[model samples]
Target: MNPKDWSVSQTLMHAAKIYGEKEALFDLKRRMTYQELDTESGRLAAGLKELGVARGDRIGICLPNWNETVVLFFAAAKIGATLVPFNPMYRSHEIEYILENSKPHVLFISRAFEKQVSLSQAASLVHHVIAVRFKHKGMLSYSEIIDRNEKEMVREPIDVDEDVFCILYTSGTTGMPKGVMTVHRSVVQCAFTVSEEMHCNENDVFIVPAPLFHIFGITCNVMTAIASGARMILLEKYHPKTVLQLIEKEQVTVHQGVPTMFLKELDQEDFINYDLSTLRTGMVGAAPISPEQVQKIRKEMNFELCQSFGITETGSVTITRHDDDEKTITETVGRPLPGITVNIVDENRKPLPPGEVGEIAVYSFGNMKGYYQMPEKTREVLDDEGWFYTGDLGILDEKGNVRFVGRQKELIIRGGLNIYPQEIEAVLLKHPEISEAAVIGLPDDVLGERACAVIQLKPERSCTEDDIKQYVAERIATYKVPENILFSSEFPVTASGKIQKGKLKEQVLEHINA
Candidate 1:
C-alpha cells in the first residue's frame, strides 16, 4: 500500500507483519518485539473500548517516555481515538488549562504526578482518570486494563484522512494553550517522508531522549521509527552519562536531541571512553546547533548531525540530507522537504529576496488541521490558503535553505523546550509584591538560553529571587521558571509606554557582563 493511504494504526500492523520478531523497543529494561508490541497494544485498544472510548473520543496522556506510552500510542490509534499528550513537567495549573481545553474523556497519567497535581482539579474536566506506574484508590489501573485475553482488536471502519488522531497543546503568544489538531494522513505522510529523507530502515537503532509528548518525540521520532520499522532505546529522562552508556550499549545508530543534550554528552568527563562508532546520522534541533558542535558530533561522536526547523503547527518541513555539507548542515535548517513550500516575508507579509531575514511562513500537507475549538486563534496564524505565518524569523537562501535567525516574539528555548516570555511574565504579575515584570531569554553556554525575569516592586513590597522562583515553580512547570531574577525600579519602554524587551535584554546582558 502507498504510504499516504496508511493510517498511524495501519503503520503498526504493517511493521508487525513484516518484522514480527524484530526487537522494536528497548524501554527501560523491558524488551518487546514488533509482534508483542502489536499484540499488547491491541489488548489496550480493547480495554479502552471497554471503558467506552469510541472512535473520535479524545484520550489524554501525561506520562514520561515509558514502554506504556509507546503501547498507548498505537492503542489510541487502533481504536481511532485522538491522543492528547501533555508534558509530564506541567504542573496543576498548566495541566488544568490544557485538560479543560482539550476535554479528553480518558486521561492516563503517572502516579508520581498525583502529589504535584491535584487530580481533583481535573476531576471535573476529565471523564475518567487512569493511573500508570502506580496503583491508586478510586482510579483505574493501566495493568488491569491491558492484562486480559485479547488479540487484534476488531476496529470499526472509518475515514482515515478525516479522522484526527492527535491533539498537541502548545502555548500561544497570549499565554493560553492551544490544541494543535493533526489528522492521520499528515502524520503518516510526514513519517514516511522523514523515513525516506533520513534513509532510516529496520537496521537503524535510535535513542529517544526527547519527551514523547513533544513534537520532536512524536512525529519525528516515534512515528518515523514506526514507519521505518527501526528499533528504539527509550530514556526515562535525559542523563548525559546514561545516554552515552545507552548509545554504546545498544549500538544506537541515530541519536536525536537538542543542543543541550549533545553538549552535555560531548562534555561528559569520560566522553571518549564510549564506543559510539555505530552512530551514522541523526537530527539536532529545537535549540541552536553551533558549527563547532556539528564538527564535534561528526568527528568525535561519529555521526552526520542534521539540523531541521519545524513547529508543532507544521511537521518538520525542512531537514538536512546526509549528503549535505557540514556548512549547510550547521548554517541552514536544510532545503524544504518534498511538497513543502517555505518563504520569508517582510512585516507587510510580502515575500522577501533570498537571504533576507523575515517571518518564516510554511505551506505544507504537514500543517495542522486546525487548533481544536479555537477557530479565531487558529485564523490568526494559519490562513485560508493553508500557509502558516510562523512568528519565527529566518532567511530563505537562494538554494532554498532556511537559516533561522530568531523569533519575532519573545520565545525562550532553554534546551529544546519552547517557552514564551509572556507566559512567565503573566506568572510574575500574579505575584503579590510585583507590579510590572518582563521575562527575556539570556544567552547561556549550556542549554542555549535561560529565562531572566526583571521586575519592579509594588510600592515597598519585597520578595527574594527564590521566593519568585518558588512562586512560578508552583504555578507552572519548573523548567519554565526564570532561572535568573532581578529587581528593577524602572524598565525600558517605548514612547507609548510598552516595555521594550529588546532594550531590556540589552541592559540585562550589559549588567551581567560588567
Candidate 2:
C-alpha cells in the first residue's frame, strides 16, 4: 500500500499483523504487545460505536501517559472519530472552556483530577463522562467500555488523505487557547518524517516523558514509534531518578524530552550512577537549550542529540541530524524536514534575506487544517497562499538552517532598540552559576519596555545581581543588559515543559510592586 493512502487505523492494523508479538507499550501497571494493543482498541471502538458515536464525532481525552491513552488514540482513529486531547493540568475554568468549545460527545477523564477540574460543571456539554482510573458517582468506567467482548470489528477504510483525526488545544499564552484541527494525512506524514529522520525502527525502544496531550509528545513519540513499529515506554509522571532508572531497566534507545527535563536529569547528583549506555538517539525541543547544555548532554548523557524546532501548528519543522556537527546541532535548528518549505519574512510578508531576522513562515503538508471554528484567526496566521506565519522570530542561514531568536510577542524594544529575549537568556544560561534563565520585557516609562532577566541558580552556587549584570555586559552590548535582575528557585512551566515567560513577567511586576 502507498504510504500516502495510509490512515492511522491502517498503520495500527499493519503493525499488529507484522509485529504481533513485539512489545508495543509499557506503563506503570501493565505492558502490552502489538496484538493486545489492537484487540483492546478494537474493543473500545466497538463500545464507542454502540454509544452513538459516529464518523466525525469528537471524544475528549484528559489523561496522563498510560496504556489507555494509546488505546483511545487508536480507537478514535479506527472508528473515524476525532480525538480531543486535554491537558491534565488545566483547571476547571480552562477545562470548561475547551469542553464548551469542542463539545465532545464523550469525555474520558482521570478520576484523580475530578475535584481540581470540577468535572460536573462541564458534564452538560459531554453526553458521557468515562472515568479512567476510578469510577465517579455519576460517570462511566473505562472497564465497562473494554469489557464488551464483542467480536473484533473490521476497521473501515478512511480517506486517510484528508480527515480530521484530532483536535489539540494550543497552550494559550496570548488569549483563549485555540483548538487546532489536525488531520490523519498530516499526522502520518509528520510522524513518518520524524521517524525516518531519527532512524527509528522496530528494534528501537522509545521513551517519552513529555505529556501525551501535547503535539510534540503525540507526533514525535507516540505516532513516530507506531510508524516505526517500535516499543514505547510511557511515563505517568516525570521524576529524574525514575526516568533514569527506566532508561537502565528498559534499555531505552530513543528518548525525547524538553530541555528542562534534560537539565533536571543532569542536575541529579547521582545521574551518573544509572546505566544510560543503551541510549543512542534522542531529541531536545519545545524550549530553547543553550550550547553549554547541548555539550553537557552529549558529553555526560552519552546520546547522539538532535535539536528540534517546531510548533503545534506545524508538526516537526526543523531538526538537527544524527550526524550533524556540534556547531550545527548547538547553534542552529537544522534545515526543514522532507516535504516542508520554510522562509523568513518581513512584516509585509515578503521573504527576507538569509541573515536577516524576521517572522518564520512555513509551507508544509504538516500544517494544521485550521483553527477549529476560528476562520478569521486562521486566515490571519495561515495566509491564502498556504504559508503559516509562525509569529516567531528567526534567521535562516545561507545553508538553510534556521536560527531561532524568540517569539515575536516576547520581543523587547528598549530606547528604540530591539532585544530578543532568547538571545539574552542564552547568555545568562552560559553563566556557570545559573542553572536556568528567562528574560522578559517589563514596563518602562522611558524606554517603553525594559529587559528583565530572571534566573535560577545551580545548587550551592552563589552570584550577586551585579556579578550577573557584569557577566552579561562583558559579553554583549550595554543596551542589551537587563535593567532588572530577579532570582527564583524555579520558573513557571506549561504542561509540555516550556517556560511560561508571560507568567514570569507577571511575577517580576508583582516583585516590583512589592
TM-scores, all models, native as reference: 0.81, 0.98
Error of 1 at 322 (Å): 1.4
Candidate no. 2 TM-score: 0.98
Clashes per candidate, residues 3 or more apart or on different chains: 0, 0
Cα lDDT of model 2 by residue, 218-275, tens digit: 9899989999999999999999888999999999999899988888898898987999
Once superposed on the true structure, which residue ranges of model 1 sit more than 4 Å away at CA? 149-151, 411-514
Pick by TM-score: which candidate is best?
A: 2
Off by over 4 Å in 2: none
Candidate 1 lDDT for residue 270 = 97
RMSD of each: 10.9, 1.2
What is candidate 1's lDDT per residue for 231-284, written digit by digit as tens? 998988779999999888899988988766786687678999999889888888
